[model samples]
Target: MPSPLVVLSHLRWDFVYQRPQHVLSRLAATRPVFVVEEPVHADGSPRLEAIDAALGVTVLRPHTPVGEPGFSDAQLDVVAPLVRRWAVETEALGACDAWVYTPLATPLLDAVEPRAVVYDCMDELSAFDHAPAGLLDRERDLLGRADLVFTGGPSLYRAKKDRHSSVHCFPSSVDAAHFGQARPGAPALDEPADQRDLAHPRLGFFGVIDERLDRDVVAALAAAHPEWQVVMVGPVVKIDPAELPQAPNLHWLGGKTYDELPAYLAGWDVCLLPFARNRSTEFISPTKTLEYFAAERPVVSTPITDVADPYGDIVRLADTPAAFVGACEAALDAGDADRQRRTEAMRAVLARTSWDATAAAMGRLLDAASRAPSAHPPTPTHSSTPARATSTL
Candidate 1:
C-alpha cells in the first residue's frame, strides 16, 4: 500500500477549491490524504479539528491560543505540539510523506517523521502585502530539508531553481468539464441570484480580492462604461474593505464557493484578470485564466509576465487603465468569428494539461523516493523528528 500523504498548507480547505485541493484530491484516490492547515486562534486548549473534505481527504485544522497570524513563530510554538500529537494519534509519524505549501510550515517538519518531504511552492508568500517576518529565513531552512521542490509556474521555477537541486514547474491546470457547464450550448446552469438581475455586458472576475487586485483598473473600467456592470467575486482579505472603489455599476459580491463559481461565470459576457504591477503579483499565474477559457469567455488581463509570456496573444493584455478599458471594450464588441477563433484556441490550450496528469507525475516522483529511501538525505542537523519529552508540559 502507498504511504499516507500529509499536506501542510496555508490555504483553508473550505476557502476556495484551488491548486492544492485539486491536485491533492486527485492524489487521494490512491492513498490517504491529510491536509494540515495553519493554526486558527481560539480560546480553548490547542487541538486538531478533523474534517473530512471529500475525495477521501481529511483536513486537519489546528486551533491554538496564539493570535498572531501569517505562520509566525508564536503560532508555530502552539501548532507544533498539536500536530505532533495528531501525527502520533493517526499513526502517520515516520510512515507518511510531508507535502508543504508554506515555508513557515518548515518548523512543523520536526513534528512528523516523513519518509520524503515535498515543498510545493505555490506562491512567493514573503512578497505579499503584510507578510510575516522571518519568512525568507524559514524558506531557506525548508529548501535545505526538502527532498523535492515543485513550483506553481515558470516564473516561480526560475526564482527557485538555483536554490534547490530538484525543482519542477507544475503550472496551474484547468478542470474543463466542470467549468464547461458555463459554455453557451452546454446544459444551462441557473444564474446565481445576485448576478441574475444584472444587465448584460457583464465583465466579471472571481478569485481572492487581495493586494494583487488592481482596484484602480477595476474602478476605471467601471467608470469608463456605466452601462457595463462589473462584478467581483471572492473574499476580501489583508486590505481594508472600506478602501475599495465604489460606484453604482461596480459590484463586490464577496466570496463564493467553488461550486457556485460556474453559475456566476455563466452570466458574464467577458472575464477579467485585473492584477496590479507589483511585487505581490510578480510571479502569479492566475488559475482563473484557464477557467475563463474553459467557460468560453473572452479575457482581458494586465501584462503580468507569466500571463503575457505564455498567453499574450490569446488573452488581451494591457497595463494602463485606458488600455484595460479598451481591451475589455474589444472583447465585449468581438464578432462571432473572433469569438469562435478564441474558443477554439482555448480548447487547444486546455488539452495540453490537467490536474489528473499533474498528480500522477507527482505521485511517480514520490513513489520513486519511497522506494529509493536514500535518494535524498535530510540536513544533518534535523535528520529525524525529535521525540517528545513527556515531562516538558
Candidate 2:
C-alpha cells in the first residue's frame, strides 16, 4: 500500500472547484488522501470530522465552538491537538506528504513531520483583501521548509522561483472535455429560466464576483452598450451588493453549478474577464481564461498579466472601460471565419494543457521528493496516481 497524503488548504473543500479539487481527487485513488480545512464552528469546542469526498479521498474539517473559533493562538492550540492526533495516526501507518495551499498552514509542518512538504502556491494570498496579518512572514517560512514548491502561474514563479531551492510553474489548467460541451452539437441542457428568454448577444462573466472584479468597468461597459445584455454570474463576496454599479442592461445570475456552466456559456456570444488591475489581481491566473477559450467564446479582458502575456494574440485585451466595450464590440462583430481561426489556434493550446497532466506532474514531484535525502528519512517507494482528478463539490 502507498503512503498517506495530507492536504492543508485555505479553501473549503466545497468552495469553487479549482486546482486543489482537480489534482487531489485523482491522487486519492492510490494514496490515502485527506484534504484538511480550517476550523468550522457548527458547534462549540474543536473536533476533527472527516467526510468521504468520493474518489476515496476524505475531507477533514476542524470544527470549533463558536466561542473558541479561529486558528489563532489559544484557539489553534485547541485545534492543533485534534489535528495532530489524526495526522499522527495517518503517519504511523506509513510515510506522509503534507501538501499545503496557504502559507498560514506553516504551523502544520510541526504537527505532521511529513516525509515531503509541498507548497502549492496557487495564489498571491498576501495581496488579497482582508488577508491575515503577517502572512508574508509565514510564506517566507513555508518557502524555507518546503521540499517542493509549485507556483500557480508564470508571474508567480518569477516572483518566487529565486526564493526557493526548487520551484515549478503549474499555470491554471483546464478540463477541456467538460467545457467543450459548450461547443455546437453538444447536448445543451435546458437553459436556466432567467437566461432562456433574455436578449441575444449576451455578454457574460462568471466566477466569484469579488474584489478582483471591476464592477465599475462592467457597469460602464453595459451602460455604453445597452443593446448588449451583460450578465454576471457567481456569488458576490467581501463587497457590498449596493456598491455594485447598476444599469438596465446588467443582470446578476448569482452562482451556478459546474454542470450548469456549459449551458450558460453556450448562450454567451462573448465572455468578459473584467478583472481589476490591482495588487489583489496582479498574479491571479484566472482559471476561466482557458475555459472561455475551450468554450470557443470570444474573450475581452482587462490587462490581466497572466491572461494577456499568454493569450493576448488569441483574445482581445484593453484597459479602460471604453476600450473594453470596444473590444467586446469587435468580438461581437467577428465573422465566422475570424472566430474559426481563433478557435483552431486555441484548441491546439487546450489539447496540451489539462488538469490530468498537471496532477500527474505534481504527483511525480511529491513522490520523488518524499524519498529524497532529507530531514525525514525515506521509506519504501511511493505509488503513482492513475489519472488527474475532478470533483463536483
Candidate 3:
C-alpha cells in the first residue's frame, strides 16, 4: 500500500481548487490523503472536524478558540496535540509522509515521525497582506526541516533556490479537456445565472481578489468600455470589498465552484490577469493563464515576471489601463487566423504539463526519500531546468 499522505495547508480543501487541491486530489488516487486546514475560531475547546472530501481524501478542519485561523504559533499549539491524537486513533502515522504548504505549520511536524517531509512552496506568503508575524523565521525553520522543497513557479524557484538544498520548480499546469469544454462548438453548458444577464464582449477574471489585483485597472477597463462588461469572479479576500472600484459596466459575481468555472469561461470574449506589480504579486504565477489558454480565449495580463518570461510569446502583456484596453481591443478584433494561431500556440504550451505528471514526479521523490537512510537525504545537484512533465490531451 502507498504511504498515507498528511498535508498541512493554509488553504481550505473546499476553497478555490488550485494547486494543493489539484495535486493532492491526483495523489489521493493511490494514497490515503488527510488535509489539515488552518484553524477556524470557535467558542468551545479545540477539536477536529473530519469530512470525507474525495475518494481517498479527508479534510480535517481544526476549530480553535484563537481568533487567527492561519498556522501561527498559537494555532500550532492548539492543532498539534489534536492532530497527533487523531493520527494515533486513526493509525495513520505509521509509514506516512508529511506534506506542508505553509511555513507556520512547521511546529506540527513534531506530531509525526514521517518517512519524509515535503515543503510545497506555492506562494510567497510572507509578502501577502496581513501575513502573520514571524513568518520569515518560520519559513527558515520549514526549509531546514524539509527533505525536499517544490516551488510553484520559476520566479519562486529563483527566490527559494539558495535557501534550500533541494528545490524544484513546478510551474502552474492546465487541464485542457476540463477547460476545453468552454471552447466554441464544444458541448453547451448552462450559463451561470449571475452572468447570464450580463452583455457580451465580456472581459473576465477568476481567482481571489486580494492585494495582488490592480483595482484601478479593473475600474479603468470598465470605464473605458461602457459597451463591454468586466466580470470578476472569485471571492474578495484580505482587502475590503467596499474599497473595490465601482462602475456601471463592472460586475463582481463572486466565487464559483471548480465545476462551474468553464460555464463562465465559455461566455467570456477575453480573459484578464490585472495584477498589481507590488510585493504581494512578486512571485505569483497565476494559474488562470493556462486555464484561459485551455478555453481558447485571448488573454491580457500585467507583465508578471513568471507569466511574461514563459508566456509573453502567447499572452498579451499590458501594464497601463490604456494598453490593457488596446490589448483587449486587439483580442476582440483579431481575425480567425490570429485566433487559430494563438489557439495552436496555447495547445503546444498546454501539452507540456499537467497535475498528473506533477504528482507523479513528486511521488517519485517521496519514494526515493522513503528509501534513503536519513530522513533528510543528501541534496541532488541543483538544476535550472523546471521539472520535466508531459501529459496527453
lDDT of each: 0.85, 0.80, 0.86
Q: What is the lDDT of residue 187 in candidate 1?
A: 87
- Worst 10-residue lDDT window, candidate 3: 384-393
lDDT of 2 by residue, 1-393 (tens): 456888888787776777788888878767888877888766655678889976768888887774543345555676678878877676443567889988877887677778888898878888888888878998888887888888888778778777876778888788998889897667876788879888988999989889999877898887887788998989888899889988888899898877788889988999999999999999888889889888988999998888877777788899998899899999999998988878876776786678888888888778878878374423322122111112111
lDDT of 1 by residue, 1-393 (tens): 778988989999988889998999998999899999988889989888999998789998888888887468888888888888888887544498889999888988889878888898888888987777888998999998888888888788879878887787788888988899999888889888898899989999999998999999999989999999999999998899999999999999999999999999998998999999999999887889889989999999999987887777678999999999999999998999988887877777777667788888888877777766667632222111111111121
What lDDT tens digits, residue by residue, belong to model 3 across residues 1-393?
A: 668889989889888989888888888988899998999999899899999999889999999999966887777888999988987888655778889998888888788667788999889998887888888998999888888888888888889888877887877677788999999889999999999999888999999989999998998899888999999999998889999999888999898999999999999999999999999999998888889988989999999998888777778899888898899999999999988888888877777777788788887777677667285455643323322222232
Task: Write down the RMSD of all candidates, one decimal each.
Answer: 8.6, 5.3, 2.5
The better-scoring model by TM-score among 1 and 2 is 1
Root mean square deviation (Cα) for candidate 3: 2.5
Give the best candidate by TM-score.
3
Can you give the lDDT of residue 245 in candidate 2?
87
Model 3, residue 369: what's the lDDT?
Answer: 73
Would you give me the overall lDDT of model 3? 0.86
lDDT: the better of candidates 1 and 3: 3
In TM-score terms, candidate 2 sits at 0.92
Top candidate when judged by lDDT against the true structure? 3
